[model samples]
Target: MAKWGMVIDLDKCTGCTACTTSCGMENNRLPGENWQDVLFYQEGEFPSGTLKWFPRPCMHCENASCVEVCPTRATYKDADGFVLIDWNKCIGCKYCMIACPYGVRFYTDEKAPIQPDVKQVFKGDGQRSWNPPWRAPDSRDDWKHGVGIQPNGVVSKCTFCYHRVSKAPKGTPDLNPANPALREFTPACVVTCAPTARYFGDLSNPNSEVSKMIANQRGVRLRDHTGNKPQVYYLTGGAGGAVPTDRRGKKA
Candidate 1:
């Protein structure tokens, strides 16, 4: 009965974009299709102003707007508190995309390469995310919990790396403080954060790091007026920064 969530310490983030890169490779995202992004904005006067960066991901709201407007129920919240998209059920209507206040969703449109570079992102679990188009006659269908590069015309966004979090040890935090693994038991964005600006844990657990961060740092969610209740929390320190509304993974 764990509700998974993340905390992005804005004070610690350096806008290095390791999270975005890892997410792209792990999820096999295209050039313009960014599931994780660092939203940048400038505030105040030019010379006296400041440049700030906010690493943006899916909010995974308690009452997600995307889920509410999905005509086909393709976008839904899982029992574990993660909002997800069922690719098979998605009808390419773009309703969920419109409903998302963060503007994080992207309509996939033939972004896959003709012959995917092995050096690029994975297409299956063993090799890549899903079998290439050429594998149609004998597609690899056994990759359980699979989410290959989304087909054309479907809107897709971050899933909080649901595939990894689901396998975490029960009752225990996903990323072990004593022995954290960069390539296991965490979302690609969280694990690859070089500065360790991100933290993910079970929010329902009072003792979890995420819960403690929110309590200790007064972590705030984005766009409070929307009443979306984003699970992702931010702790702003130093100068703090403004997040760009169109944070669509503009090449990090």
Candidate 2:
């Protein structure tokens, strides 16, 4: 079995947010609930100030705190390196939210992150929070893997596009968007990256691009001190898009 992972080259990232847009559309996310987000920060002073952006996604940690704290076992990590949420098992306790150091988890039922709630605009028929008109016809409600539109009370976050990635050809080393055949199985965020900053592949394979990048390019994980051991890695060119010392003041 392949241990899936991602490597992002911050030097190449232009902070275009195309990844964010594609992820929201692909997953039928509500406004302001972005699975892939570009976080901006400023460094230095006055005239010498430098503005940088960090693309934030679920760390998919090997030692995931979310999985550890879930009282209902709603959150789990698989052998293939995916950290997923089982919406059916979830009880809306938000323990996973509090446990996540990345703050990538979301509970849309509480308050609208943006004005003029879209859920109110397009109400769902039953348990679904909203019925998006433009929802993908092929989209499946595999709540076990955290795919599809979330029901009223469950928490949601990035699943490394499990609905699509799970369908990739067996033994495929990398899911490069540039490859026409693999495009269909690639994650929406990786496919839409304008600068080709994102890379996805099996971490266990020493030959995989993701693994080689981490070895050669000096890739780093966010908040690694927490011992979450995030699968996602970043390659900042030591300039723009540098990781924040503290994304939020408080530690998780």
Candidate 3:
């Protein structure tokens, strides 16, 4: 069995937010939604200051706190290791959102951030800005939008492109021998990154690329103390936008 996971090398990340943009467009998220957002903030003070950034996606934890708290079993883990939500079973209770430590989940009907620059919202397009690929006028009975069915009034989060991954034939080869392309098996954010900072593959196989990276680079998962056993790992070694200390004077 293959357990899908990801590794993000912070040393190669540029904090350009390409992953965020590609994730939104590929997932057809609302104007305010950011499924793969990057955390960028200033740290330290005075001359020692530096800018640090972390790209955040659904941790897809092994324990999956969201699944445990859901009354309807809307949040569950698949055999492949991704924490998924079934929109049909979701009762809009938001239990999963509250339980999630990473704060990555979102409700579908919340007020989308206004984009006044777009002239008018949707104009005359359709019901939602982007109709889900699985949607048919006659059938709307699926439990969740993990496959792009993001129904209104449900909590939703990243699915690691399960729809795409599910389509690939069994025993998919390693994707990291070279830079992965925007293929059906690759997540949009992974392929679109200019810096090649993100990697995705099966974690169960010790020889898999993601596993190798985790072992070789000393990758770490955020808040592992929670013991959710997040599959996503990050390798940190970059200067993190460090600048030289003052050699001359100060004040402008």
Better of 1 and 2 by lDDT: 2
Q: What is the lDDT of residue 1 in candidate 3?
A: 62
The TM-scores of all predictions, comma-separated, are: 0.81, 0.95, 0.83
**Clash count in backbone of candidate 3:** 6
Per-residue lDDT over 1-252 for candidate 2, one digit per residue giving the tens place of the 0 to 100 score: 888999999999999999999999999988899989998877766798788889999989989999999999999997778999998999999999999999999995878889898888998877788999998773488888888888888899999999889899988999998999999999999999988999999998999999999999999999999999999999987766887865433476
Q: Candidate 1 at residue 80, lDDT?
A: 89
Model 2 lDDT, full chain set: 0.90
Ranking by TM-score: 2, 3, 1
Q: How big is the positional error of residue 40 in model 1, measured in Å on the Cα after superposition? A: 1.7
Question: lDDT tens digits, residues 15-63, model 3?
Answer: 8999898887677666567888887777768798677777889999999
Using lDDT as the measure, the top candidate is: 2
Task: Point out the higher-scoring one by TM-score: 1 or 2.
Answer: 2
- Per-candidate Cα lDDT values, in order, are 0.75, 0.90, 0.74
Alpha-carbon runs more than 4 Å astray in model 3? 117-120, 123-145, 177-182, 241-252
